[model samples]
Target: MRAQEMWKVSDGTGITVAVIDSGVKDVPGLEGRVLPGVSFMEPPVDHPDQKYPPHDDFDGHGTTMTAAIVGDGSAGGPQGLAPGAKVLPIRTSIGTPMAFAVGGEAAKGVRYAADHGAKIVNLSIGDWYSMDKIRSAVEYAQSKGVLVFVAMGNEGEGNNAANPWAMLPGVLGVGAVDENGDPLPSSSHGQDTDLSQMGGKVLVRCKKNSDWCVQDGGTSVATALASASAALVWSAHPDWTANQVARVLIQTAGAPRDGVKRNDYVGYGIARPSQVLLNHAGDPGAPDVDPLAAPAPAKTPTPGAEQTLEPRAESAAAAGLSWQWPTLGAVVAVCLGLGITVMIKRRRRRR
Candidate 1:
């Protein structure tokens, strides 16, 4: 493909993607491009309202993944798949060695996104199983028409079953691929998951004022790549529903297997976002119909699931300004006209 070919066709210009991970740093390429995000772990202290801050980066992982999805600046790393799209960084993970510890942060991020109005939610996280709170969050996003994409987890070598979070109906589970288009050792696999994208070896934004890049692997990268792909597709086909986009991804995935058969390793083959963005894939069926409607509550936090207050919460700022406003570009007219684009953020900031 041409340099930023996907970007030219669709730069995720109006899309607002939430980066749920170690806070994102404000890199030169991403400066002005990223909006104030949420930080759940840190107490805002004087800045009580801002649980999350704007253009923050901490462990470098969030920024790296953010670059894959939205960075277009040639600072010192690889350009993003969708340079024009805005990023809403959420400090969901502390880059901890364990996964359960971050599940709370991820849950907080999901609630914030749905409440704020992000159209597409990008979670470059793994190990947040698809059980109670997590499933509720995913269900809530789907009810609001938000298309949530998550990393399929980096347990492929350990024979980890497809990450349950990815298998959730409305959620898009992505796997990792090397530069040569082969599955990575760490990328998880499953059948119910959405698709696959480039996750193995690549460069990313280091931080603000620094254009330096680094090499990395894991489903986290794949999730970022897939998030950018969704932004491109959503930005172009403004009317397409979340289901339609998801259906296209599955229909056009790299390898097709009989039924929903998932290998103990790679999931439903690899996701080919190019197919949907390029309109080469088949229709995603119903616009109003949801793939995740069976088990979970229509919106979540309904009956049996545990309920908790958001780690942080804030009013929206402006149209296309919130980490939850993934459809900002698509709904800018509606939001601006209604003066409803209040991009408030709750949480903490890092780096």
Candidate 2:
């Protein structure tokens, strides 16, 4: 990615990305870079003793995601791709047992971030199911000129159902790739995937301890990098609108290996922010023209049905299992496990 070389041109100054996930901790590398955002998860009914503060990370997922975007490499911590950018933490319950119950809360967080001056929103959390509230919130963010990047999910070998968030209009669905630029088998694929980024063997701030850990890779990390890439470009061109920024990213991305415009596996190909930051490549088209076309509307539920939000499965963190990692001196390796999933339950009312 040549993040350091790109930094010589623009280190993402004056850009703010909202991380809507578990929570962001005030760690060494991210000092003075995280904003005091809000939390949507209430005290879990089954676990009232647990409290989720917006700036305090319990599962370590949110903290790692935040560090990947804006960590300044303080105290030997992982250096962020866009160290000059600021992060706005919006805490949700995607990694907790209560994840299935807070779909509306996550939607509310999206609106809160957009209204609070966030230019880009990074959603590393997602589910197999879609909620009307979430769809509405994504639309609202687009209306506010906020660019949203969502993880395409990690079920490539399984069902690989398209994540509703990624399928939403105007949202960039990110996939994962290895150091050699080969697509990771775990990265979900579909028509919704917009771009790919380094997601395998990536180093991130450990959620268990202060030392750095290596993540085997998931779309979550890729989404963070993609979001940071946008921050870098937006910082360099402070006058560019969200649409223009997105257009350049799509235009300058590493071309597909088959020499085609795009593919379901890598979208427009790997995201290379340096193309815009250093080489001055890509054309920022009309500010009002969106590069990604919105998909068709989802089928509406029956008029008198009871709706509820749920998760396809519980996360490893919710099971009280710290993510597994291999130790190498002070550094360790960890698996982010599966992509977070949310499901919606609906019941027909008696006519």
Off-target runs (Cα >4 Å) in candidate 1 are: 1-3, 42-54, 96-101, 128-130, 159-162, 205-214, 256-266, 291-351
Write down the TM-score of every candidate.
0.72, 0.81
Residue 44, model 1: Cα distance from true site in angstroms: 12
Candidate 1 residue-wise lDDT, 57-175, digit = tens: 44567777777776654545557777778888777545433234466667778888877757788876644232456667777777777888877776666544444556555676676
**TM-score of candidate 1 on Cα atoms, chains taken together:** 0.72
Clashes of each: 29, 4
Local distance difference test, each candidate: 0.57, 0.70
